[model samples]
Target: MMAPNNHFATLGLSIGADENQIKKAYRTLAKKWHPDKNHEAGAKEKFQEIAASYEYLSSKDRREMLERELRKPAAPAPPKAPQSTPQT
Candidate 1:
């Protein structure tokens, strides 16, 4: 799954955007990329992605989940093993 930030980026919004901002961005993007209005290549796919992002961000529960995820500290990276030298 794409990171939460990517969803916000898809709609040209920051993670801090409010519901009204999300709706406005979705409306603008939907009108611009709606397949019926835009015959250009990839319009349908773009519209789909925009719609999905809007839906994901619109739900209060999902938004709360996202906030919780953001609050958690990032997991530590796995330690790298020592490199072995090849014998000639």
Candidate 2:
């Protein structure tokens, strides 16, 4: 199966979007796609996806944690010592 898009894409926002921007986008989309509010065939499903994305991105700590994890440097592998050849 194909993988789903990231939370940012689901909300139509960039990964670096601020909390305010995220909230604004989510509110706008949620209002537009809400099942009761829209009554469209796929509106309910779309709203659920949006809600899940918003819930995940809404947490400042989680966002920061993901950012830090992405930004952290990877450790280098240790060098191997030279091997000496012995007479057979």
Candidate 3:
């Protein structure tokens, strides 16, 4: 099952992403994952998820309402440090 916050995950974006970033990511992914263009086995499902994520993020007025109701952004992840091989 998809997680509750799967939309942001699908777009490879932080949950607090501003609308422009959301739109930009949507356009980039949509072009890449469009089912007819992309023949990967899961491309249709991926495209659907991307379209829905974009729709959810595109609703500016609705987001304002949701933000007022929730009063908090989703947790922002800390940056990851580069991984290094351990001495063996």
Cα lDDT tens digits, model 1, 1-88, are 3344557778998766789999999999999999999999999999999999899989978866876776667777789999999999
Each model's lDDT comes to 0.86, 0.82, 0.78
Each candidate structure's TM-score, on Cα atoms with residue i matched to residue i, is 0.77, 0.66, 0.64
- What is the clash count for each candidate, in the order shown? 0, 0, 0
lDDT score for candidate 1 against the true structure: 0.86
Candidate 3 lDDT over residue span 1-88, tens digit each: 2225446667888656789888899999999999989999999998999999789768887655544544455566788999999998
Flag the better candidate by TM-score, 1 or 2: 1
> Which regions of candidate 3 are displaced past 4 Å?
1-3, 61-88
Give a tens-digit lDDT track for model 2, residues 1-88: 3333468878887666889999999999999999889987999999999999889888988776655654556566689999999979
TM-score of 3: 0.64
- Candidate 1 or 2, higher lDDT? 1
The 10-residue segment with the lowest total lDDT in model 2? 1-10
Candidate 2 collision pairs: none
* Model 3 local distance difference test score: 0.78
